[model samples]
Target: MTETITGLHDVADRFDAFLIDQFGVLRDGAGPYPQAPAELKKLRALGKKIIILSNSGKRSVENSVRLAKLGFDEACWDWFLTSGETAWRMMAAETDGGARKRCLLISRDGDTSPLDGLDYNRTEDADTADIVLIAASEGDRYDLGHYQTLLQPAAERGLRCLCTNPDKVMLTADGKAFGAGRIADLYEELGGAVTWIGKPFPDIYDQAKIFLGAIPPRRICAIGDSVEHDIAGARMAGIASILVETGIHAEASPTERAALFALHEAAPDFILPDFRL
Candidate 1:
């Protein structure tokens, strides 16, 4: 059975490093959680190495800037890593002899920073593109049916999709909303191939291990809100995990929570009501 705790203080001395998730664990889309910054500072004071491990589709620098704007001090964490940054680095290091592929990008608010330094050409027409990139979610502005129609052409063309954010749901200003991973799921259902690049996958964890330096897996703890991504991924990476209740499943009933754990076949080592000291 998983142990429940009030805050990080309960297990502070158990781990030397923490891999914290961004969206649901630290803040919602609108702003930072009230006690988050202070709690992080407290952890830092205790000599705990912190890394903001996120499945966000934006690059690491962009996320850092957003966190700063949200009032999180830069001194709270040692380094930041995002699935988008990891994917970008992988693409940059690829030695394929083929020419640059034409990319049809789908993102929230039309942001294209994921492709900023890449060699791929952006395309508006799906029929003419060689690949599809699902970087962010626009669920607030459009429905799933809209995405199904928009991606049908690309699916018919068998364009490969690279999904940097593998979170199926996200905490938005209006509560829960579909994330980019949902769009990627729709593409797969439409017969298109997809390559997931974020949490619950090995690539991002491999990169995170490098950033975490010499910390052994036993001394590392991953804290996040999603059981599918955070808890499951931590298990896959051979580290301890803590699930906070103040994020994506904040309102889930006890029964619903149990079903979710059963569905994912993952249980966190600890559970907390929020991220606090």
Candidate 2:
């Protein structure tokens, strides 16, 4: 039988390794949470193999550099995996023709996150893009009208649309739901097919697990902010999960937390408010 996770230490004791979420629990979009890096170090000292399982839509070099700045270096986890890397590779492979190296990207405005070989053009330069890539942008300035103007026509002309992060919205520390997953949701609504490159999809998770040197599923803990991706993916892989209460759908009150549990009707083996313990 399964159970609800109550404390960080309780869950940590049960697993030999952890696959944690980045944007919400460990750090916000702005900076690192003080408790997160410390918790990661503690886990490392105890001999756990830690991997930052992120839906970050950027290259591995960019991801590694950012994590190092956030203090996730040799002292913390042993590995880091990004949705950006997976998505880019998949997109690069899937399209054999149609302007081999060009794509139109809709990510956070200041984002230079993709891999080295992946080529891109701005929406303003949509006339030249061969593929339309939609992720989360920085501000609300890039709305439906923006996507329609740049991406819709490309879709109609049979160009591929790639969604980097599958999550629609994320919870802020102050408690707000904001994310890029919504754009993917909408594009799908408009009958545009997209290839999700993040978790809840076995391809990425299996690849991450292999990075752990062939660890068994039962020995791993898939921790994250969202139930749809983390929990559902863990279910498919037969691994346990820990829900961090700091990301999208963060718990403002214990009662609200319980209600969320009820809504998903799926319980995390452990619930961490932050990375403490």
Task: Encode model 2's per-residue lDDT on 15-59: one tens digit a residue.
Answer: 788888887778886678877777777778888888788876776
Q: Write the per-residue lDDT of candidate 1 for residues 1-277, one digit (tens) a residue.
A: 8999988888999999999999888889789999888888888999998889999899999999889889899888887889999888987886376787788998888798988878887887898998898989989889999999889999998988999999999778887889999999999999999999989898988887887889899999999999999999999999999999988888998788888889998889999999987
The lDDT, on a scale of 0 to 1, for candidate 2 is 0.69
Candidate 2 residue pairs in backbone clash: 57-84, 58-113, 108-137, 167-181, 168-181, 168-182, 170-178, 170-248, 171-248
lDDT of 2 at 176: 45
Which 10 consecutive positions of candidate 1 have the poorest summed lDDT?
92-101
Query: What TM-score against the true fold does each predicted structure earn?
Result: 0.97, 0.84
| After superposition, candidate 2 runs with Cα above 4 Å error | 1-7, 92-99, 110-115, 119-128, 171-177, 252-265
Q: Highest lDDT: give the candidate number.
A: 1
For every model shown, the clashing-pair count is 0, 9
Best by TM-score: 1
Candidate 2, residue 248: the lDDT equals: 65
Candidate 1: residue 39 Cα off by (Å)? 1.1
